[model samples]
Target: MKTFGGPVLFLDRSDINTDEIIPAKYLTEITKEDLKPYILEDLKLSGFDPKDDKTKNARVILSRANFGCGSSREHAPWVFEVNGITAVIAESFARIFRQNMFNCGMAAIELPKADLDLIFSHSGQSDAAISINIEAQTLTMSGGGNQKTFPFELSPFDKALILAGGWVDYADQKY
Candidate 1:
């Protein structure tokens, strides 16, 4: 399975739409690699800069509720995949987008609002990082001078999909 967790990109907002994740205009690009430079190009987060080094280096995304809230295309996850973002942890996700993430061998993790609030509290720390242990269903966030661990649960099928490197590979094995 693909390795997950590392330097995190914190998007402190809710209802981030598909268009903002990857503008619709670039969907025509022939290869996933072509979509790399445009990830979150249209996201209007207050302090976000898509061109910033932090954004480019982020291996996971931490966001608020309703992430991937618009459109049903798979391109959003594809953009993240090509950019080397293997996981997105949010308070909630648009159903289709969540499934798309798993289909692409990427994680779409949901934590309760209380847990998200606790995580976001550390957003100000530039060194913030998250370590996810899929086998244990735990997320550990650490930065500055503090660290905390939280528990999460995934269904058996979801776990299988992630372990098998997404739906395609899971199907290949099962069939």
Candidate 2:
């Protein structure tokens, strides 16, 4: 897949678990897209509207450590995918959550501690823009006259799943 760029939705907070991604109450929804409305239900209580254009239009998610620590709910990444998040760049992600992202055809890039710190420092800025180069395995963060490119790690096998449009698509081709 070619690289894509978009405004960054920087969630400065950390330790965001699966429940925060999609509340358990909405997990029973027939489809993952149905859970999009509650992508960050907990944020609403903090005066953040999940339906706001900023959130809805964000294609890149920048968060701190332990991004998805709680449940292994696949719906978490599904919520992100349906909401237009093709890439998630964080300092760290729970093991299962990272896999879930790949299963959903979303890039879950784990940035080095130093690189993550740089990104976080620019959070909340009006011009925070980040581009993800799927093929090149690079993340370009630019805004406010600043730009930097950082390399992320992703196994070739897992990358294949994402480029092929998730596991099902890959399996279809091989089988």
Candidate 3:
């Protein structure tokens, strides 16, 4: 499987439900482009507008406990991937959400509370920099500290999907 290595951006929060990630109203749609504009809409205190924000490229998302804590919609992770979220770091995650992310070939890691805090602080700055090196299993930050690293459960199948550039691409390759 192909691996990811990059900086991280921390967002500190707990129990981020799937409905907050993507409301029920948008589920009728199939295109991820349609879902992109609404990601974290309910969670954003000021409302989220992707066009006006350049954080779209933030490679890693660090959050508090239970990051995806609601519903079983597959669309949750789909929206994240469509919007260019490479990895997610959190204290914990919902089973379905974690599986969905892995199925889609996105990396999800768990870190201690202290490590989570470092990334969270960066969100306030004009330039927040957090780095992730998957092969080395390390997270670096602007302040020069290391974060807790855990195993990512990438099955051989999941790795194939990521290496082939996502599920659809992998499906096409095998078929």
Candidate 4:
């Protein structure tokens, strides 16, 4: 996608592993549709339930460092998309999970720590809209007459896959 923008949810924690994304019990399921109800189930323990009205409708998830650090299960990103998340912005991510996100068609954008902290700080305000421009490699945070743009990076291959709509779509066009 050229621009990732929408109502965002702040997953303020760090090192949120795969087991936490989909829970260990739901691992056997192969279809993203089948895994929707269970997305972010374990977040309930931490008092963040994705099924809740506002959270469930969130199109973006913004998190701190080491997000998706545990397992290499593709189901983690699968469940995210099934639950309506189109993109994820984080300061850092686990390698495998980052790859899985692209494979599953989710935009995983990385930003520097200072920028991430500012974004996190702004999450407290309701009705804010965040926009990320892929080509410019910048994030624009806007709300209530306040706006700021922060620079970010994306690899050429990763950027291409996301713009082409995930790995499968990218391969389909090339092959």
Candidate 5:
């Protein structure tokens, strides 16, 4: 299974779309690796630079609701996978986007608004990071001398997809 969690990149906005995750112009690239370096290149958030070290090093993304909005494309998740981002934690996700994440063996974790508020409080701190334990079904956020844990659930099929390392691998084993 893909490892999840590490330094968190907090995107303090909602409705972040696929085009922002990866500009559509690069879609014709030959490989997922070719799509790297362009992830989030078009995202226009105050104080967020796509080229920043924070972007390059983040292994998990924390964002507000409606992440992965806009077009339904597998390339968005491919970009994140190439970037070594194993998970995205948000208030909610676009349905297709959430499925696509699991299809790629990545976590699309949803937390209630109150829980998100608590987690967002720890964001932007230099030491902010998260630890995800899928088997335990819990997310632990720590930074600024504070820590919090929250529980989340996944459907049996979704859990199986993640554990088996995505749909293709799951099929390879099951069928």
Candidate 6:
């Protein structure tokens, strides 16, 4: 899997659900581009266009506890993928969302709330950087000397999936 690196955009809170990631109404039959506009619409509560907010450069998303709760819609991860959110760092995650993320080439990192607070509380003005070295099993948040290490439980298949650029591409390669 590609190491998660670059700037840290901290969102400190809890109970961010799948529906909040991608509203249930859009779950019906939407193209990837159509779904992009609704990501974080429910939670960010910002009427701004979701597509405009999240792009390839918005590398890391840091959040609080139970990060992907509520319904297990595949669309949740789909929305993240469409909007170019590569990784999410949270205190904890719903089991399904975690799996879905790995399947879709998105890295979900779990860390203690205290560690989360340190990163989030760093500053609002400067552009801070966060790096995750999978080989080293460490997470370093730059600009504040706050660093922590944690275990990531990824199945071999999931790792391969991520490295291959997601499940569909992985499948196409194998079969």
Listed per model in order, the count of residue pairs whose N, CA or C atoms clash below 3 Å is 0, 0, 4, 0, 0, 0
In TM-score terms, candidate 3 sits at 0.74
Candidate 3 — which residues are off by over 4 angstroms?
Answer: 1-9, 44-55, 143-175
Deviation in angstroms for 44 in model 6?
4.9
TM-scores vs. true structure, each candidate: 0.96, 0.90, 0.74, 0.89, 0.96, 0.77
Candidates sorted by lDDT, best first: 5, 1, 2, 4, 6, 3
Residue 44's lDDT in candidate 6: 70
**Per-model CA lDDT versus the true structure:** 0.90, 0.82, 0.67, 0.81, 0.90, 0.72
Candidate 6 TM-score versus the reference: 0.77
lDDT of 5: 0.90
Q: What ranges in model 6 sit over 4 Å off?
A: 1-3, 44-57, 144-157, 168-175
lDDT accuracy of residue 165 in candidate 5: 83
Where is model 2 more than 4 Å wrong at Cα? Answer: 44-49
lDDT of 6 by residue, 1-175 (tens): 5557776655566888888788889887557777877777777733223445333356678888898998888788777767667788898989899888887777887887777776777636355777776555567777655554445555677667767878898888788
* Per-residue lDDT of candidate 1, residues 128-151 (tens digit): 889888899998999998999999
Model 2 TM-score on a 0 to 1 scale = 0.90
Candidate 3 vs candidate 5: which has greater lDDT? Answer: 5
Find the number of clashing residue pairs for candidate 5.
0
lDDT of 3 at 115: 59
Q: Cα RMSD (Å) per model? A: 1.1, 2.0, 4.1, 2.0, 1.1, 3.6
Candidate 4 clash pair list:
none
Candidate 2 lDDT for residue 29: 95
User: What is candidate 4's lDDT per residue for 37-109, written digit by digit as tens?
Assistant: 8878777445466668657777788888998998988888888787777788998999999998877656888
**Position 37, candidate 3: lDDT:** 80
* TM-score quality measure for candidate 4: 0.89
